[model samples]
Target chain A: MLKPLGDRILVKVDEEKEQTVGGIVLANNAKEKPQTGEVVAIGTGERTPDGKDIPMTIKKGDKVIYDKYAGSEVKYDGQDYLVMHEKDVMAIVE
Target chain B: MLKPLGDRILVKVDEEKEQTVGGIVLANNAKEKPQTGEVVAIGTGERTPDGKDIPMTIKKGDKVIYDKYAGSEVKYDGQDYLVMHEKDVMAIVE
Candidate 1:
């Protein structure tokens, strides 16, 4: 288990679901990779100039959509993860 | 003047500063493109599921560092700009 530090998050990307139209199966690569993910771990919080903690809005296990190009890729234990600042998250999916 | 909508911001990217060691000049491309920028325009806020607004943390004229891979590039008035979510801004440069 990886623990992130300070305003960072570990995201497990959601795979694009298969879609078919008129009985024709679409190639998996044809669809853009979904920017959605499940948050696994989060950092404590960002610090203000005065050293106060700026509370993070997103929480662990929150399903989130993020900027398509945000974050860095990390491979661990044969799995891939994206570590991003909480701000890279664009929206919380309903 | 483009007014961003909904928690988005326009950033003017900071150029990579030149570096020298022992009077040897380094190629500009040898250095990574800086992730810092000056905020220009900002969106009002992102809305909560219940229609409440989540005010933006980053403001116009603030110098911020963002994820290198974040944001989309646009050329406006012959100048380059990046449009990104406020969250993508990792830190404010003091």
Candidate 2:
């Protein structure tokens, strides 16, 4: 259970299934596609110049979409996760 | 003289001289190097979550160094300019 700092978020990346066409799996060499994940943990939030907290838009268990190149990858307890700023999240999957 | 928007600063790029060695100029294809510029105009500032102003660190007439891929390029009055957020500026050259 890693606690994120500031406006950072810890996300558990969802396992993406390999794409297959005609029963042949396509190799994904370019990882530029967007990724989806579940919010595992969230930081307190960003602070204003006056030090007031800015409320986070995403919460725990929320399914979010983020850019491929955004965030740093971390492995904790044999699990792979991404730690990124809240701004890296593009949208919440309904 | 284009005015920048919130947190954005307008900068006039300093012309970089071609690298010459032994009276031969070397062509530079990779533009990943940082660049220097003179600040021209700036936005009022960014707003806090509660709408308070976050004062800008850089001001007009300041010479600054910024990331190579930081901003949008603009052409104004036959002059090239870059409009980027103040955060894009790495430092001010004294």
What are the Cα lDDT values of the candidates? 0.76, 0.81
Span of 10 residues, lowest total lDDT, candidate 1 chain B: B27-36
Query: Residue-wise lDDT of candidate 2 within A1-94, one digit each (tens)?
Result: 5666557788999998988999999998675589999998887677568756689998999999999888766655688787788999999999
Give per-residue CA lDDT, model 1, range B1-94, as digits (tens): 8888887999998875668878898766653432678998999877667676666767789887666788999899998999998767655554
- After the best TM-score superposition of candidate 2, give how far the Cα of residue A87 lies from its true spot, in angstroms: 17
Chain A only TM-scores, each candidate in turn: 0.79, 0.90
Q: Which candidate number would show the highest TM-score if scored against the true structure?
A: 2
RMSD of each candidate relative to the true structure? 12.1, 10.3
Best by lDDT: 2
Determine the iRMS, in angstroms, of model 1: 10.1
Give per-residue lDDT, candidate 2, residue A78: 83
Task: Give one clash count per candidate, in the order shown.
Answer: 1, 0
- Stretches of candidate 1 off by over 4 Å are A1-94, B20-25, B28-34
- Classify candidate 1 by CAPRI docking class: incorrect
Runs off by more than 4 Å, candidate 2: A1-47, A51-94, B29-31
Q: By how many angstroms RMSD does model 1 differ from the true structure?
A: 12.1
